[model samples]
Target: MPVVRLCEDMKEHPKTSKHKCPVQIISLDDQGGLALANEALSQCLEQGDVGDAPVCLISIIGEQRRGKSFLMTCLLRQLQNQEDKDASWMGSDDEPLEGFEWRSGPETVTKGVWMWGEPLWVQVPQGKVAVFLVDTEGSMDLQRQLETSIKLSVFSILLSSYQIFNILSEFKLVDQDYLEMFITVAEEVGKNFNLYPVQHLDLLIRDWQHTSTYGVEGGQEHLKRVIKDLESLPGNDLVLKVLKAAETQCYLMPHPGTRFTRSNRLGDFEKDFQDCLKDYVTTLVALPAKHVRKDSNGHALTGKQLAMKIRDFFQFLEENHYDFSSPVKMAETLANMREQVNRKIVDIIKGEYSEFVLHQDRDTQTETHCLNISPTEMQKKLEEKCQELLERCRRELLGDEQQKEAMVQDVGQELRQMLEGFMSTYNWRFKEMENAANRTIKDKFKQQYKGYITDQGRENKARLQCCRVQPRKMRQCLEKKGQELLQQCEEELRGAGDRKQAVLRDLEQELTEQMDDFLSNLE
Candidate 1:
């Protein structure tokens, strides 16, 4: 069974002070099969606020028994100091490095991937970021099978944003070959997963022989020489290409004195070694923004998001029964899976768009009265709703830039076409309804004006008869009075048409003429 050593159960060295210990996140079975320690991994990566905050993972990988774990222990101490706000990250002179298990021996201590139980929360310019340290089983161990090493290295590369390639004394051809193979596989995996293959790689060379040259300056000089030498050789193009493409840096360290090596304790570090280590750790942790893990689109990954991705990768491997030996086969499987996911995502977005339109249509039909809205207004609203849906689709999309753009174009075109069709039908219906309304209002106004004119004529005729005037004089009086009534009716009717301005001009002229005729006949 895989063991998850609890923090309290971890053994503390008699001579060194006790501190938090790392838990095995990935364990190897007796048969050398990989198994994810889900409970332990989740506890470390997905708990409380740290899980939701942006995360940075730093992992170290190299040959077996090269102080890889010791280096990680140093990093852990520095981070803890920062978290506690100590006067100096470098603790007391006699403080023993206590985190990852390391001892002076030829045997490998870490068998699989181990992660610090607690995440170090650091505040930077970008805001608080959670940093996780990973220590992988060292590669190129004679006792370990080749497949195990490959799997461990691949997992390390996939999980880490900042990868430290630890070397004993110098960079060598074998190291270059191993790095090339691991990175190539990682790049292939990243292509299908919408992740960055490698963000930052640090080449850490320990126990440098050169006395005058140390630290970053010596590391850069040595790296240039190594690359130049690789260029002169044949069949080294791939490694050279990877090295140049990735964001890489180098750091060289002098041996931590012969006494420290023999004792394998932090207090035994040479004065120069301790100072250099301080400088390295301080610089590394100070620039958290540069190391924050990001996706293919350059968006930072929260701790929860990073954890999900890791789980997804392991799940994929398990489902496919990956043997961890064939990159080509793995890539093929990933390609097939990606195609399926893309199709599903597009289908989902299209369905959502359809549902949204249907809901809007139902809302419009259920209204008790017409909206009195113009086609232009309706079109504007439809476009905005469609744009909102498209934006949501864009956020959920996963793929390379070219693939995402193509999907977006296809989806956008479909939405635009749908909007155009809906608008065309809507405009036609609105025109019909508007014309009907105008005709009804026009008829009502005409009848109302005719009635007023007839009433005025009757009253004038009755008044003339009552006066008992001569017929010619009565006719003159009736004509003059009828003209005055006609002007009054015109002014009253003018205000009613203000609501229906489109037909007002024609209705007004027809009503005026009819009223004038009525007044003339009365005369």
Candidate 2:
């Protein structure tokens, strides 16, 4: 990826250079409907120098006029410095922050999700990753509809790997309520879709009055207190669950100083506020790999993959006509999507199994006779084949390990039942073939023995007539003939046993060949 710096003069650069600025990736139509800036978002995610690289999105969300845009601007500067390995990331303090538009006013400035057009290329142990800075429109504006605020918050959480939940003064009841609702929605969506919805959540308390606790240590203390207090409450289970689910952090920033707030410049900010800000931004960018966006399985996502997921989520909402009016409605939508995914998994397994059976049948048709494998060996091969199918299905399943395992077990049971039926049919056919072969051999031996006995009787009659003159000689001849007939009968019985053994041997060889073919096809 290229190392492109933010323009020094936003006005002149817009006219003279190809350097890009933050662009809105999501917006609201005049009719109050959600509008996705597909082309713009695609440009930022797919067409840039960061193409196909794993991405780490950093987004800031808070109430209106809470310096979210300004903070993103600071983050942009820090990112630039981090990329260049320069200590002068803050640049000239007199230079006004020029990334995302920010000003001290009650009115909202950013209307929707705005993404910096160019990604900061950060090198990590795994090579390089792209980091995108996002500025979301502030939430809880009285002028905006409740649904709008919810939508913005949801989108922010969905798009960012590291989200800064900017708050004024300290964490309050209202913040808790809003956060709970947002986290609930996120959690629901995540559970249904098998996604890691919240990766890192940073509760950034602005203008903290507590002088003793200022940075991370203080922030952590305050968070524990708040959590403990909420734990005593009756209905904060979801909030607690989400907190535990994500990696949480808190930072208390001292007031940026009155002069800096008035001038909207870095030079006038309090030294302590500046120091804290630097620390926060540095820590965020220090280990980009740690914050890389991942799926539920903790596999990092490339830019294009991330873009597709974002688009898919928004498209689902749009198709469902979700108003984002209530968490209940969100839950219902997610449940529906989950069901669809579940059905898709079932269908995939069914299709794969069906194909496998069909292939086996085709191969079976080419065989001249039944492959006589022992029942034990047959059962073992069938079980192995079933397991192979289960593993294939497991890969197609999406969810946490526990959920995936449950689904796999269910599929496995179904496969075993099917194989049981198949085994029954095979065993029945093999038994029928064996019984028929035995009967045919018995009938052939019976006919030959009957003919031999008749011939021996006629020969004995002729010999008796010829030996009538000598009674002793006749008796001796008759005894000898009887002994010869008995020996011949025994030899025939032995030959029949040998023929049965040969048939069994042929069947065993055929079974081995069939099993080898089946296993090779599986591989």
Candidate 3:
């Protein structure tokens, strides 16, 4: 295996290496660098084989030529030591597996966001994690504008789980401005993006010196004071809430200076810097990895989701003129999402309820055969079917409680309408059945009258009695039986109507009850 550097030329990636390609994943440029970075990051993720491990991204940002890359290298080495005591520096066939290069110059080298070739699988107190390192381009560039600086700063902070602000001494005016911008935008982040992991900032002060008279507690205290002072600035209330001093850890380190080689090799770094850095790296390892989305369930979002979120975030910024704290824009986004869920709920209701109607119609036909079918029995059957469909509709609801409840009501109302339609059709079917029963009774009466006439003609010898008395009596008796049959048919139709009305009522009650239960669960 051979190590390849990210943010470098792809042609330079070692062809023979199967295990490593430590090359520049992305070098952000105007035309297509971001797209390339996205692709490279994707490929890197695939190659790293993170397995089932949770991923933690740790990145560095600060002034240009401030050894931010060197600091990242130091942290990686220390973390590696904690990962495996007997791990070798060389890969297969003596291939170099060392980290970022460091030189004693005041010129910027690393550009844009850079990721390590492989993720470090380390054990934290919580659990094991696959850690990726990001080295961002340094700030305060003469070539770039303040706007560019702000964008890069925001991107780095949003992307990383743990960020190292590698300052040579103190926070510059630009740094303060960048931080303030982050604070302001962070409030609106949740409305639009999956702001995961509650990013942690660590101010690593290098080339340390005591400038404060109240530095009785040493560099950590001084760091805290700096942060406190930043937080105390006007309009810093939101920033302080998001990036509190308690959440922000601070570490102090001396300049490697002449004691370290310029070769950027791990073996050549100063022992003192290594020792101090070990604890710093350990602190990072102990911190758990974050998900971009706050999971309501046990599962967390994967690396792919983070990548997609980053893409969408930038797109949103571009379209909205980088207006981070735009309530209107956030609200619009939410409205669009809610609309989508509403449409989904509609589709689910139509499909599920339609299927239910097909089954319910068949069942009603079979059940109608029973002359004594009670309203209670019909209600039980309707409730069973309605309850099933209601549960399916409940599952279709998405987003916040308000949106979910609104969708539940929408489903219930639509379902009730469907039930009413079914009842109307059922009433019409009952009318047809009643008509058919009446026609059968009339036909039976005609047959009986013909038999009575044939009997009277055969007894012609008693013509007077047969024609007058018997015919009159038979006609009267037949008319009375016909009336009774019609009354029975009318009674059955009325009973069927009552049962249909009962089923409809039961369905409406069930829908309302289920809607209440679903909304309560959301809370």
Candidate 4:
């Protein structure tokens, strides 16, 4: 059975589990007059001045059995162990998946405020993450709680393996059946989610999310979309020239001849991402009724079509939190709504890129000149091969590296060890997270307030707003890179990581020796 015990520190090294912070949640009912109650609630939340706590409120909305309860519970688990960076997975054979992987563990956090019918609040890692999961009454029936839902900084629409997009497109399942529910949800998200557009854009470029991104987010067309769409957004136009001139050149990795090379690159997806973002930004900034409606339903797209596709993308962003930020205080998160929009564009590109890699085969047959020569000729080929032949071999090395690169193999092993070490420390943090101020919370609120008030007109990239990072992805990336270099590192680290990286030299000798042995066996 899965371990349901909650611990603050998830990545503990066969060590003590007495550290992690706790998660507190109180559940409330889902039945009530949402319009009236939500209005009063928003006024209270907006004005409460909860001194020590954060003001950001989250509203969880979903159809019945759409894993709403499951997602909420999982989210709470993350919150409970906010300090546990070690909340990682052990090998999947016998041990259970913990934290993100394992839903049921003994680890728990200091519980927070919760309500049943009203709103259940759970903490988030950074900012003031309190999820006000509003449980609906009837299954698959959306309770029109626009006032409360829109007030949230982020909104999520949960789906299970069975659930899909277009709630109204498939069946008319609300009051008056005039898409009143759909329109309300869409407009609220678009408006509040798009607050202070110009200011948010500046923050995005200079503050929360890192500007050094090598993805589509790091390019000229991307910046243009932010400027053009944000400028045209229904609201404000914060930065003009800065947005106009913000340009980027996408590189798969650092320049060629670098120590590390990108395994696979996606150029087309980068362009598509830019195009979609440009179009989306333009639509929102203009806030024009240019969206064509296929049916009488007020949704911009036809029965689950393009015009209304923004809402679906918006929902995805809120759900998975497709935002970016440089923890080093680099980019502005809320300088404009384009930050969120940019993330959507990023997600679309990343998804396509991942597919590009996954769908392609790791193995392929290539035609080669297999000279029908006696053993004598085969020896002559390697012995006589000089500069030109070696260069050709250098080019082939990349393909071999892609297929069977020991550097990647060695790096992968080391990455696992490094990740393990990091996780061990991470789990330790979870145990005593209460001592440290919620860095996540502080960073988030700081960015939000900054994005709200920063000089959007400033063209400098330094004064922008930012996203709140918890070092999760960084650690993961480090681990991945390490894994790729594990084997190479074993030999390199043999001398205590001091020796020059002779990876290509060593691997080539080893391969040549192995091939020579194989060929000689014919004797």
Candidate 5:
């Protein structure tokens, strides 16, 4: 359903010429091509279609201004006509070409990657598989660098299930060297970036002369000899290794001698090439569906996923500055890595900080008495912990120390309020303890005064003659007892104060030493 709606939304307008169609799949800027495949692909995802369907992708690559576009045009036309087996399509002489142009004396007319409006649906053994076509800008463009060309080739190979390597003449040593360069770069890219799959490479030897030696034996032997000699060349064993790993196929075609030179000539050359072209299309369609980049379910990428991946590919190329040769570019990459590490560190510290605060609260809950701590002191502890963590991260992650300091300050401010709330609860508990202690001391003094009065009454009766002396003596005795009671209350208060001070000192020492040890490694 997704693909059906996708096809409907992305269907090409019949009136718009292919060359001028605004919905071109990709376009190039100064840096590289942008994958605009989402224009149609997004609809595919929206409609719940093309789910887990295997897909086969074919891409063409070759030297510039060598009728690559023409070949693509011819190939696409034949492919589209396959659904209508009753009709036969031949190049028109009376009208302008309808698809990709056959431009002559080119200044590299094809700029970036281009794709057919809709993928051709073919029934394979697996199911209905969509065959996607991608046509890239030819290699060795006058305006592009060798690095750019290699990147484009690598990019194309990465995106396709089968890659057509189009060449103007017989395969040469220069071709081997170019492939060796690609192998090296591909290996590196696979290790550092996304790991690209080894796809089937179809070597298309264009403009082959019809000499007797140009037969199957000659072309096959030539390719084998090149591979054999390439093994002896410096650092070419890797190229051979990659070729052996991939499914390499070759096709040799003779030159289309004056096939479309005249306005109305449709000669034997055209007929023969068309027959061969039909066979090529047949072989292409019958080729088993190979999902080079499959999702977890081993299904080919949906339209949306494919579009996004294409975007990421070009972005990857741009970020690397076409190649990782410049020192400035490499430095930028390192900076980006550091920034990523900084973000991860922030996340890790947040978790650690939260867990620590939770444990601190639990520890307070298990204490015998409410801690007599002030809001300012609590705030200082929280800030110190935050700052310690931030400094550690700065030394280890080495990214935006100022920014990290600001973050720590923000976190500290937030936790400052939490600490204040906890301190309020502790203060309330302390107030209750003070009230209880006062009541117990008052009750003890009251009971002791009553006993002293009773004893004094008995003594007064025993010395009745010295009543005046008794009054003064009783007063002195009462005063002494009262003094003793006051001393007892003062001693109890001093013990309470000492207990409070001891608790405070123990807490301060424990936390200070813990924090110091935790931060020592950072220093």
Candidate 6:
């Protein structure tokens, strides 16, 4: 639950005494794996002197081939495009531009370059980091990857469904290997912190780009696909910005435990919250109404007979003849009275309920006010609420599991079928159609014309040559037959020109009439 937010130098985070960087050696297993990893990590951490370099590492953890590389590319390019807006280093005419670093090969350093510089780190204004973006192998083994993943200081889990159904996710979601591993890691994480809806890559930018989707087989197309994914996501301004930023950062590490996240809707620690709500509703219906007026002799009676009788409340009294003046006597009697009648509206009871209700949302405002309560009282009341919430959360989780189990299988099956159909249709044919239809007539014409047309065409050559030879005079040469060869050549050349012009005239006239007829038809 304790997340370490690393700035450029891990300033706010206390440096791990064993190492300069704020690295925690986590050991979720007893196999001495943590110790071994930590030793390696300690060395890695020592070598990593963040310096004043604005760099932070965010690791994407997920099942194999689940769009991790694509997601990373999308983030990187999205950032580059965004950076272009500032009119800075991007697209400068004078300088050779610096393009972002990205590659998809498995052994490629850090699983596709996740930000080569500090552009993304600037988002955390209060913090500074030179991001060393990484995508690890073996997300198939979720537990170990996650334990390793958390070391990145930030991570994200991606799941896709109409509603995130785990079983539906079981097959259609991520690979079985990854799902098992990540879910276990997520559950274990749940034990520590209330997870919020994770920030996943959503890209649909491909829609607007005029480019071919072709690339090396199985190479990254993350930037191209995720842009369109924004449609299904919740439209929260901050969250959307957060996600968009996540894309460029070469990672999305949106934590689930934070407020305003899906975790709020989880209702996990939801104690019988509605009970308290109902009580408040009832109180609003009633008010600070005086109901009981008991005398010093403890022979108290309310005017409303509908309420429980005071004689029944007296049954709580252990000794009938006890000292009335003792504070302890009054306390016992009151306690007994409350337990016995169970219907009396006590002032103390109302006060306790109000306090509990006001602090239900234990956040900034509520927490500040809670300090007013004595530690003991707060603990007792909160414990009661906490227990109720946990119980409710458990019930909800079970109900969700049952409901999900029954329906998710059907949905997952449907989804798998739909995905197959989608792949068949869209991935191949749809893309083919898109590729086919994508060309504009003008574009096709230009492409077709590019090399076909000549600047110094035959007509120009003929025009230049025709200038010195007078057409009428050249025809006259046929009559001079002095050189029989020249005479025949001149005759044929002159006749050919005249015949060609005549034919072209006919074509022009025919074309004009056809165009006129077409216009008339339109009218």
Which candidate achieves the best TM-score against the true structure? 1
**Would you give me the overall lDDT of model 5?**
0.54
Could you give me the TM-score of model 3 versus the true structure?
0.58
User: Model 2: per-residue lDDT, tens digit, 5-86?
Assistant: 1222333213111555787777765545666777666666787555578899998877888888888988888887775555
RMSD (Å) per prediction: 6.2, 11.3, 13.7, 36.9, 15.9, 37.2
- Candidate 6 ranges beyond 4 A from true positions: 1-59, 62-74, 77-81, 86-108, 111-134, 141-177, 197-523
Q: Which residue segments of model 5 deviate by more than 4 Å?
A: 1-23, 30-52, 83-97, 189-195, 210-219, 261-272, 291-299, 314-523
lDDT of candidate 3 over 70-144, digit per residue (tens): 667656765666644332321232233257655657767777667776777766566666677778783346476
Q: In model 5, how large is the Cα lDDT of residue 417?
A: 59
Regarding TM-score, does 1 or 6 come out ahead? 1
Tens digit per residue, CA lDDT, model 6, 1-523: 2122112333322343443222322222332121112232222222344332322233444444333443344333334343443323123223321222223233323321122222232333343333333344333434444334332221222111000111111122243233333433333222222222222222212111223321111113433233335435554333234335432212111112222122222232122322222232232112111111222122222222101121122223223422222223433433443233322322233344445544442421332343334334444555565345333333222112443244334433443443344334323433333223322322333332222222213333467553544434433432232234223333332123664355334433443443344334323
For model 2 the local lDDT of residue 115 reads 87
TM-scores, one per candidate: 0.79, 0.75, 0.58, 0.20, 0.53, 0.24
Q: What clash count does candidate 6 reach?
A: 21
State which candidate has the highest lDDT: 1
Going through the candidates in the order shown, the clash numbers are 0, 0, 11, 96, 1, 21
Assess the local accuracy of residue 144 in candidate 1 as a C-alpha lDDT between 0 and 100.
Answer: 72
Better of 2 and 3 by TM-score: 2
RMSD of 2: 11.3
Residue runs of model 3 more than 4 Å from their true location after superposition: 1-21, 30-33, 51-53, 83-97, 123-128, 138-142, 154-158, 184-190, 211-220, 227-232, 258-272, 288-299, 310-523
Cα lDDT of all candidates, in order? 0.72, 0.71, 0.54, 0.28, 0.54, 0.30
lDDT of 5 by residue, 1-523 (tens): 1110112233442212232222344444565443344444343221234434555667777777766777676666666666645225544434444566446564676665565545566676767766666677844564665645654555565556677777777776666666665555544333232334445677777777744354334556566766777776777676677655536756666665674633222243454455555566566655646644453224456555665655554454445433333323433543554455456766787677667666656655522333434335555766677677766654444334455467556655655555566556655555465545544654565466656656656655576564524444555665566566655655554225765455334433443343344234212
> After aligning candidate 4 to the native by TM-score, how far in Å is the CA of 107 from where it should be?
29
